[model samples]
Target: MNRCSFCNRSADDVDTLVAGAGVYICNDCVALSADIIKSKPAGPKRTTPVWEGVDDDALLAHLPRIDAIRHQVDDDLRSWVGEARRRGMSWDRIGEALGMRRQSAWERFS
Candidate 1:
């Protein structure tokens, strides 16, 4: 059995379910970590790369496109989960990979 690096919970695997880097957390720890990361402010310096000489108007015009792409990505993730389920992957494993509860994964995908 694999043990969670953050909480010592027994698991079948130690792959990074969410949040890359060397953090190997259990399903429960993954959910808590996601919540904490989302709640925190963006911090003083923006981590995203900014294009040199890009005007404010040009950046503003891309917001809608960015939102559309985000929605598409969410849809793709749901479809991927469904496909994974068809291939015999368990909901618990899927939930852990998504940093969510099993019920949450089902509800979100369904």
Candidate 2:
């Protein structure tokens, strides 16, 4: 089943949802976000990348943080796929979700 991109609630759990390109948001989240936007003024637009102004030395120093985040996300993906397998979701479905071939998904995660 499809899930909200922000709240992670499945389609069966929400009353309404709108689909965007490769993303989904439910009505509850839309209403909550609208309230948040009303309460806080928008900030200035960021016309440049966040890392654009950083010096080479400072950027190199951030490599460990980025690496750690990547590792954590990798671990999370493995666990999520493992749980989906336990729930009897087919390898084809998993591969489709991951945009890979079923054999590749099984070889990677199984």
Candidate 3:
């Protein structure tokens, strides 16, 4: 499943997502962005650099969530490929969807 680039919310968590060349934004995020744009003053400024305040403890805490998302996405991909094959889709097309060669896709997912 795809996740919003800004909020990290998965596709399952949001109603819809606007996909772009290499990014996705969930509906909730899109609304938030629109609101932000309309109200222009912006949030308060921060003195710290991005992630500079993220200690090892916080990083370690987020690791499992990241891993879970990765595993879920991988499982979704495998199931989607299986379904596509069942529906008479070609390996070449599957490979194209994955941006890989047919042999590579087969070798990886078949």
Candidate 4:
């Protein structure tokens, strides 16, 4: 069975499976990707890749700070999402910002 290239969902789990050039995309990923593409605002998107260079010991030492920072980021995101909604942004647009489907974003944030 083929797995989705993006989310790694197996073909058996999805309602439909699509393949092209040795790559597979399941129905859920397709819908999410479509929403992301269609709802993208007109602008250049910037992505910063994470570097996995930290040693295990160092990572363990930083766990507390990492958890705190993660919580801070979550709180900031919620505040930003609320602000965006107040500014008349659609859930689709918010989902695009968070790299998820509108329904998923609504489920998480609303």
Candidate 5:
């Protein structure tokens, strides 16, 4: 049984759910959490002006760079996981390293 991230309720079929921050939230908790988080207002802060001068072409040109960066990050993460596994690291250890729970880590990679 997997424990719910929010309430720590034992649950089955947890592999089908999303885990966040050590919580294996059930579907109900997931919906409620989403609603609560969405309803919360952003704190007042210095508002930054939106840049209107940058055209679509410039943004489009950056897509490849962004994609490359994302790919590199993914590859790096995979490499790290491979190394960890090679060194006989436990799922709990990996999850702690990633700031998540062992179940969450397994859900993400397995």
Candidate 6:
């Protein structure tokens, strides 16, 4: 039986299960999500401004540090994906977990 993609509850556990976009959400989660959405503000959203203080030379000097961080992030992502696969999670579920498309996840990790 398939499990709720969000809560990992088995199909037998939830009162109802809804499936979409390669994922499932149980009834309880759905109701909670609806309530949360209802409680949100209706005002316009605000976005963070990009930093403009760093100059070209400063950016260039940080290239090595940026590259090291990128490598570390890649290693962590690979490790997480490996562990997820070992735990019997599907590519679709893994993609959902990582907030990416299933094909993107497979292309990056597989």
Give one clash count per candidate, in the order shown. Answer: 0, 0, 0, 0, 2, 0
**Candidate 2 positional error at 48, Å:** 0.6
Query: On residues 1-110, what C-alpha lDDT tens digit does candidate 2 reach at each position?
Result: 56666666668999997876446789999999999878876788558997899999998987765655455456668878999999999999999999999999999998
lDDT per residue as tens, model 6, 7-38? 66678999998865445679999998999789
lDDT: the better of candidates 1 and 3: 3
In angstroms, how far off is 82's CA in candidate 4? 0.5
- TM-scores of all models? 0.49, 0.60, 0.56, 0.47, 0.48, 0.48
Best by TM-score: 2
Off by over 4 Å in 2: 1-44
lDDT of each: 0.67, 0.81, 0.81, 0.75, 0.67, 0.76
Over 1-110, each residue of candidate 5 has an lDDT whose tens digit, in order, gives: 44554444446744345554333457777778899788878888536653365678986875665555455456557767878888999999999999999999888765
Provide the lDDT at 32 for model 2. Answer: 97
Q: Return the lDDT, model 5, position 11.
A: 65
Clashing pairs in 1: none
Measure candidate 3: CA RMSD: 6.0
Q: Could you tell which candidate, 3 or 5, scores higher by TM-score?
A: 3
Selected candidate, larger TM-score, 1 vs 5: 1
With a 3 Å backbone cut-off (N, CA, C), the pairs that clash in candidate 4 are none
Segments of candidate 5 deviating more than 4 angstroms:
1-53
* Model 5: pairs clashing at backbone N, Cα or C within 3 Å: 5-23, 5-24
In TM-score terms, candidate 6 sits at: 0.48
Global local distance difference test of model 5: 0.67
Candidate 3 residue-pair clash tally: 0
lDDT, candidate 3, 1-110, per-residue tens: 67876667888989998775445778998899999789777678657875687999987877776676566567667878999999999999999999999999999898
Cα lDDT tens digits for candidate 1, 3-74: 455555445554443332323357788788899888888758556676555788988876765555455456
lDDT of 2 at 52: 97
